[model samples]
Target: MSLTLPASRLRTQVASIIEGTGSSPAEARQVADNLVLANLSGHDSHGIGMVPRYVDAAAEGGLKPNSGVKVVLDTGALLTLDGQRGYGQIVGVQAMELGIARAKAHGSCIMTLGQAHHLGRIGHFAEMATAQGLVSMHFVNVLSRPVVAAWGGGDGRFGTNPCCIGIPLPGAEPFLLDFATSRVAQGKMRVAYNKGEKVAPGHLIDENGAPTDDPGVVVVPQSNGLFGALMTFGEHKGYGMAVACELLGGALTGGGTWHRPADTARTVLNGMLTVLIDPAKLGTQAAFETEARAFVDWLRQSPPGAGFDEVQIAGEPERKARAARERDGIWVDDATWSEIMAAGAKVGVRITSAD
Candidate 1:
């Protein structure tokens, strides 16, 4: 069964649990808000379902509470920030604040952030930039167990590794394109496993490297005590993009890559390399805005094909989901709810529905 509740009630419950983990009220609310926003935006894979893991990570001292970011290196148009293993919700915003300022001042800024706990949604940062009428690009790599397999390789070799780009549009919503290089995010597999659902083929391989339709192959251990792996989105092409993300976000950002074997660690870290640009400073504001608007109008003019409503842009789905979820409330499956309650219990907090 799934429990549906208002966003406000969910946020309050999640914040209470976060506070139980020794986070200040402010920090707890911030983290809770960020997680809930992910759900509101329709990416439940990156949403409140992650709280149980966060609770465990905090207890293990892998996720620091009430921590902030450290500026490791800074130039007018370049920055290197260390998250001090802080909550990514905080560190991500902090890094963007600095990067946006520099980008606005110098026309562009290149910022790399490392040592942050799961950064949740990279598109959030892009939205921040687009809200400022600036263009932004993000490359991020996960530091958790290697759950994604390379093109022809068997076992897991790397994390999902996400890439995102955001551009401002005049008289319309910005174009926000964000995606995981993997055929699907591991968290989505977890959700499927909990819900007892089978996934489409080509998205996963068994522990022995053969294709399978079971999401549990990646979500749980097999009889041999090993887990299966997820495949890239476009075979070799997506594999190439994931590799680039690992190299740039992990290695280039000075956030160490995952070279060790998979462990049972609940802490998932992230390294991000971000580039922000201001069109005003680039002297292309008028042209860029006009061209963007024209192309978006052109794209929307296409007729909807079979079983479709209309042509939509990359960001429209998320925005529509946010509006719908805000009105209809969010739902949590039985398994995820139990896990979250258990996490709260561990920290001596109790979670109950307002209903």
Candidate 2:
């Protein structure tokens, strides 16, 4: 069964559930907000669907509700942080703030953070920087051991590495581009399973190295959470990006490479490179703004294909979805809702649908 609830109600429910896990109100709200935003932005896989796993992790001490980030290294344009086992939303927000501050102080900044919990939806963080009038790029690798296979290989050797790019525009929403290097993110597979649907062909390979569309292939405990390997996007090219993301986000972030055998029960190590260009330094800020507006105008005015109303930019859809959902409410499927309610019940929070 599927359920639809107002975004605010859903957020409250989710926050209540998170707070039940020993997280403070602020941390709980941050996590809830991020997950809701993911769903509103059309990334359903990254949304409230993660609540169940989060509850499990909280029970396992994977998330330290009271933890905070600490600065380890700070240079003019570079910094490294330790999340101290805190929730990723809290640490990620602070890291971006540090990155933005450094970029404004210098010409650019790169941030490497470690020991954070599951970092949901990198685009949300990129949007945070973009909202601050800065350009940001993020690369995340999984050190939790790979469940996805390298292209043409059957064994798991790569994470569903994700990369994101955000470019600030003068008067509009920023241009945001984010995607997983895998043919399909594990989250999507999980969503399909929740809906009792099979995955698309070529998305997973069973233990025997044969392609399978069954979501069971990726379900945990079926093969020690390694039943099948996720296929890479673009065959070899996307596989290469996954490798590059792993190296850059892992080794460079000092998070240890995935190739190493380490216990990855509750920590995420990642890196972000942020560049903030001073329009004033480049040229006339007004001039740059004017030209960008002109270009966008021309682009939108271009002829559209059949059934298309207007040409849109990278972040337009997500921005529109966010606006609409904010006005109305976010939709929560039954399975995810049930899990969240169950988790909330543990903490004296009762969640019910609106009439």
Candidate 3:
């Protein structure tokens, strides 16, 4: 079952916990807000569930404290940012800002980012551009190496490979589409492990290439360096996108491509590309948004499947989740809470109970 915590309380608590990692208060706040937003959007795996891992990474010297990001290259429309091993959220926001500004001037822009840890949701970045009355697309590949297997491979040879596209929708919320190419995100596996839950067969493979329900196989080194291989979501097509992301984000950005032992790496690296466009320059912005909203309305008005409530868009589900969590509380599973508490102890932070 999901564990619930007040949204504000959770964000504050997580922000404090992140501050213990030597991140600036601003960075900590940003990271916490992003994470909490992930949870509020129903992606618990990337939400507060990541606190323990971050804390552990901080303590183990895997993540440096108080690091700052910097731009390595900028040529008006093209930019390359080096995160300097700092908080990925902070770096990601900064990178998006550059892309947005450049796109505003040039009508399109591309950015290559390096030296950051697991940047959260790609949709968040896309929405950033969309909210500013621009269209945006993003491609993300893993860093510190890849930890997922290709479609037919047993070894970890690919990242989850998430991509997103967003379009401004005027009066309504922007149209945002985001997804990971993998059958299941790595964070989902981590969440399952935290909750001691079993996942579907074929979701993971043992060292011998046999399927295993035990989430521990992905964690324990003694399992024959046993790592789980994630199936590509759309078979070859998704795998192709994943490879492309690897090239664009990893190879293009000078980050190494996937290989063995990617999981035990030092810093998370992600390569990203963002493109932004202003609809007004192309044609009529208001008309485009109105037409798009009408189509969306028609699509949702269609009949829902059995046991379903209503049809929803990519961002709608997450938006609704955030609203609900804000009123109720952010769910934190027991295992995740325990991990957070333990990690907090190491960093001179306190994890208080709901009571």
Candidate 4:
């Protein structure tokens, strides 16, 4: 079962829970709004369902509250920072603010951030760069249970590593392409399991490496006490990309890759490699904007194909979702809501259903 709550109310409720986790009022609201925005953008996988995990991670002393990013190295266009396990919503912004300024000053900047506590949505950071008329790319790796299996391989080995790119389309919405290298995010499977639904084929494999449509294969331990794994999106191509992310975002960034058996640690960490480019500083501002606009228009001119209404850009769906969800309400599953309520109780905060 699901209940629809107004976005504002949901944000407030989530903020209250965050505050219970020892976050400041301002940090609580910021984190709450960021999670809610993910829901509004149609990516419920990265939304409020994560609150329960956050609470667990915090109580386990793995997630640090109110911590900030610490710069380890800064050389004009290159940066290395440590997140100190802080809330990703906070440290991610700090890293971007620093990287954005450097990009603007030097025409380009490369930054690596390690040890962030679940940097919610990578697209959020890309959007920040595109908003500033800069191009940005992010490669991020997850340091949690290895939930994604490699192509032609069996069992879990790595996370659903994600890659994102943002290109500013001067006169219109920017092209924001963000996706997990896996066929779908592990969190999406969590959502499906909560809803008692099955995912499409080709997205998952059972613990024995056999195929299965049940999202629970990855959500919960099976009878054998083993967990299934998500499959890579483009087979070998995606597997290769996931490896690259683990190398750059994990190894190069000093966050390290997942190698040992999945532990019971509630903390989920991320290592990110971000590159920002300023077109104006590259002496291609005018041509870049014009060409981008022309290409987008040309793409839109393509007639609707098959079940598609029209050609949509990468960022179009998220923007459309935001507009519609803002009018309607966000839906929270009964099970997820219950877990959230329990999380609130842990920190002495009371949450009433529908309150």
lDDT of each candidate versus the true structure = 0.92, 0.77, 0.77, 0.94
lDDT of 4 by residue, 189-289 (tens): 99999999988989999988999999999989999999999999899999999999999999999988889999878899999999999999999889998
Q: Which residue pairs come into collision in candidate 1?
A: none
Give the Å shift of residue 160 in candidate 3: 1.3
TM-scores vs. true structure, each candidate: 0.99, 0.89, 0.92, 0.99
- Residue 16 miss distance in model 2 (angstroms): 1.1
Question: After superposing candidate 2, which stretches have Cα over 4 Å from the reference?
Answer: 223-226, 260-279, 282-302, 305-310, 346-350
Encode model 1's per-residue lDDT on 1-88: one tens digit a residue: 8888899998999999999988999999999999999999989999999999999999999999888999999988999999889999
The whole-model C-alpha lDDT of candidate 3 against the native structure comes to: 0.77
Rank by lDDT, highest first.
4, 1, 3, 2
**Cα-based lDDT at residue 308, candidate 3:** 91
Mark the regions of model 4 whose C-alpha exceeds 4 Å error after superposition.
none
Model 1 scores a TM of: 0.99
Alpha-carbon shift of residue 123 in model 3 (angstroms): 1.8
* lDDT tens readout by residue for model 3, 59-155: 7676666676677888988887776666677878888888888888877777888767778787889889988888888878876545566777876
Off by over 4 Å in 3: 284-287
